[model samples]
Target: MLLRDRVALITGGTSGIGLSTAELFLREGARVAIVGRSEDKGKRALERLEVLGEVTFHRGDVSKEEDSERIVKEVVSRYGRIDILVNAAGVFTGAPLIEMSVEDWDRTIAVNLRGTFLMTKFSLPHMGEAIVNVSSTAGVSPYPNGTAYCSAKAAVIAFSKALALELAGRGIRVNVVAPGLTDTPMLRGIAGSEERMREFASLVPLGRIATPEEVAEAILFLASPKARYVTGQVLVVDGGMTAGRVTTAGSRAAVR
Candidate 1:
């Protein structure tokens, strides 16, 4: 019961890592609320979460200021306080910089960076609690044809660090979790083919892609008392993908 009696609100909680985190939070005795744009998905997540604890669904787009403000208000009105906030709503569109239109850049930035900021802005007063932002390794490394997605994620990392410093005196901890090649619906969409997925998996040192639950576990640790003294840090959950350098000899060179 690490989070007993806590109140948590998770954006993009209808699927993937957000959904997994909501389930984990509820299992640990936290009352949870999930925000999503799809009513069906939100309802399904609510149903699943209700089995563990008091759970609610707030349908809204994270990129909208009105939606973020209204959802926070609703959660506060129902739960009295928000002990945790997970900014996990994001979008990924891959295209080279020259081909990426202003709309593509704006849309990605709006949902990933701007949405995180708006959610934090509205949830902070109610958060005498913790904030866990979901960033990505793409923010730190250059990914092919990922200008928009990379830029937004990089901005998220910076935003969380700056906000963590500003909110330190308020007893609020802010941190970012940068997951690499997680097996989420979004990732599947990007993979587009089984061959691509396999190629991507082969790049990971672990020889596999991380499940959404694995990422959720890391996030829960940061939000729990275990990380009480930790703040303004980025936790990378990649399977050593970014830790190694390219070798000319490939796998055979390791035998030497």
Candidate 2:
């Protein structure tokens, strides 16, 4: 119950990691506001989340200033204030750099990087406790075909660091959670096949991909009171993937 009675605002909460985080926070006694772009999706997610506890949904695209401002205002209007903000809304693109269009590049940066920026900007004045920006291990470990995504995520980590420094004295802490491969719709869309998904999982030292709940746990930890003194830190929840592959007896571990 680290978030007991706190208010958390999570972008991209329609599904996957964002929705999972919202669920965890509510179970921990937080009044959660889930923000996303689609009204239909938001309502569906809200219906699912309501069965658990106090939750609300705000429909808006995170990458837009007006939407970000509107979403934050709506959340505040419902809960009176924001105690935690989780920037979990993001996009993934895997086209070869040579063929990647400028629009895709800009879109990637807009949703993953600019979205976090705008959401944080509007929520800061109301945020009294913490801000956890959801980065990716891709930010630190470059993957082929992930130019735009990697760049955006990397920038998010850097942004969180600078934000943490700026807000250090204000009692509002900021941190980043860089999750590795996880079982999510976005990943499913990218991998496309079970074999491809398993291939990705095999690269991890832990021999498996993370579950959305697992990454969400790491995010909640950073946002909770236990991390009061922890800020400007990038917590990599990759199940040791970023730590490198493990080998035994001079043999490579079997890929899942």
Candidate 3:
């Protein structure tokens, strides 16, 4: 119940990591506002979240300035203040730089990078404590054929660190969580089938993609007061993929 009595606002709250975080926040006692662009998804997510605790749906496009302002205003109008803000709304496109369209690249940057800035910018005035942004392992490590995603996500990490400094004096902490291959609709759509899923899993040191809940847990920790002294940090939750390449050194014991 770390968030007991707190007010939380989650972008991309309709699915994947965002939705999981919303549910966890509710269970921990926060009144949450779930923001999404899809009306149907928002309604469905709201219905499910309502059963857990106090929740509301704020439909908007985070990449748009107007929507960002309106979303923050609506959430405040409903709940008065925001204790935790999670910018989890994101999109991905798979194509090599040479093959990628200009529109695709712009959209990726808009949603993953600009969206974060807009949300945090408008919400800063009404914030009570912290903000946890969702980046990707690709942000730290690169993703093949995913130039746009990698670039945007990497920018998110840098932007968050800079924001953390700007907001530290205000008692509002900003941090980032970079997840590796997580089991989500976004990844599933790319994998396409179970065989491809297995192929995807084979690359991870952990041998499997993480669940949305696992990523959500890291987000919760950063958003909670337990991390009060921590700020301007990026917590990488990608198992050991970014740790380094797998080695056979463990198999051979040294003569000691």
Candidate 4:
């Protein structure tokens, strides 16, 4: 067990990559606190996870400072201290710059960037081991309609790197897991249908989208002692999507 008897707080833990990480941590012997904004989802997650190990759900919107502070206090009250903090809560928005509304932009930044900041700020005092932030391949690669999401995710990567340096002396490690095109409720919402999601998968060199469990494995590695020397880095789990464009043998580009 990589995290035997440790405590972990995972935001966005009710679903997708966050939920998967919670399960993995529990199996690794960590008492887990899963945070989210949806009460219904939280309840369901607790019901599903309670059998696995010691697990609790803290429902709060991480984008708000007060909520983030309260959630951290609640976790600390139950667990005494935090060994891992995973900021995985996020929202996605896409539009051309001129057509994008202020509300959409603000909401995207609030949940993705500001939420990470608030959670890390409050968790730091109680946290002793690691912080793994969930970013996206979109952080480095640009797309036509992802201005707000791309900007917020890029900021998360930069913030993690800077904080890693600041907290190195304190024995705290901060790192990032930037996943590409994972199959999750959030991505499903964006894709609108399974067929559409498959279409999106074709864009990746791997010919398939990642499972949430795969991304969670990356998070688990960063949070565990296995990565004790690893800090201030971005681990991209994109299945060669960002490596380079894939060209078929029949294509003119492949001829060169």
* Global lDDT scores for all candidate models: 0.92, 0.92, 0.92, 0.94
Segments in model 1 whose C-alpha atoms lie over 4 Å from true places: 246-250
The sequence of per-residue lDDT tens digits that candidate 3 reaches over residues 113-179 is 9999999889888899999999998899996898999999999999999989999889999999999
Winner by lDDT between candidate 4 and candidate 1 = 4
Instruction: In model 2, state the lDDT of residue 200.
Output: 89
> What TM-score would every model get versus the actual structure?
0.97, 0.95, 0.96, 0.96
| lDDT for each residue of candidate 1 in 1-256, tens digit (9 for 90 to 100) | 9999999999999999999999999888999989999999988887788888899999998899999999999999999999989999999999888998999889999999999999999998888678999999999786899988998999999999999999999989999999999999999998999899999999898889999999999999888878999999999999988887746576568767
List CA RMSD, all candidates. Answer: 1.2, 2.2, 2.1, 1.7
lDDT of candidate model 1 versus the reference: 0.92
Cα misplacement distance, residue 250 of candidate 2 (Å): 4.7
Summing lDDT over every window of 10 consecutive residues in candidate 2, give the lowest-scoring window.
247-256
Question: Residue by residue across 16-48, what tens digits does model 4's lDDT show?
Answer: 999999999999999999999889999999988
lDDT for 157 in candidate 3 is: 93
Count the clashes in each prediction.
0, 0, 0, 0
Clashing pairs in 1: none
Please tell me which model should have the higher lDDT, number 3 or number 4. 4
